[model samples]
Target: MNMPLELCEARDPKGLYKLARAGKIKGFTGIDDPYEPPINCEIELKQDNGICPTPTLMAGKVVTYLEDKGFLEC
Candidate 1:
């Protein structure tokens, strides 16, 4: 739970979270169903001071690792 549900509500008073909570939405992540994260990931980027890393940067890091490890060449 990066930001708690209460915090989400606080951030967006008219968010769809209320509908999700009321079970009006089906198969919502972290609500009616558990979120299944990827396993055996090659790279896991840690948040920098609560700031998220850009997806492009993360992908570049993974590509660099793969290239260094001879898993990929491009």
Candidate 2:
């Protein structure tokens, strides 16, 4: 998934980002360390209008991508 750093920090449910920012955690991604995005991926999930898709919807997207690529074929 390709989400912005601001969004991730804003929606931080574990408060890890907050901790990282406060120097409580070391080498945290997007804080002290860099976050490298995938160079090449089969399916890239991104936010739509700054809104993340639900888990069910994200799963459906994965299934659809697999089906389109014939990965689900038996």
Candidate 3:
């Protein structure tokens, strides 16, 4: 459901609006409704860079966490 703005603008608003009215697509963000909730109103960011541990490390942590929670087979 996430799409870059350039792709959305390329379709032309008038055409996209017509498509929405015709029900060609459902839940079109930035067109049918507000794409995201108010900034900083509902969610909080812990870091500005948004960099977390590497993917492999993250995956390992997830597997470990799931195992600890009794959700993973191994």
lDDT of 3 by residue, 1-74 (tens): 13344554654657775676578877776666667855544223222253434447656766776788788785
Q: Which stretches of candidate 2 lie over 4 Å from their true place?
A: 70-74
lDDT of 2 at 20: 99
What digit string (tens of lDDT, one per residue) describes model 2 on residues 1-74?
Answer: 88889988988899999999999999999999999998888788888987888879989999999989988974
TM-score of each: 0.49, 0.76, 0.32
- Prediction 1 TM-score vs. true: 0.49
Cα deviation of 45, candidate 3, in Å: 11
Query: What number of clashing residue pairs does each candidate have, in the order they appear?
Result: 0, 0, 0
The candidate with the higher lDDT, 2 or 3, is 2
Better of 1 and 3 by lDDT: 1
TM-score of 3: 0.32
Q: How does each model score on lDDT?
A: 0.69, 0.90, 0.57
> Runs in model 1 with CA error above 4 Å?
1-25, 36-40
Better of 1 and 2 by TM-score: 2
Tens digit of lDDT per residue, candidate 1, span 1-74?
Answer: 23344545655566667788898988877678786767776666655676656668777877898899999967
Question: Could you tell which candidate, 1 or 2, scores higher by lDDT?
Answer: 2
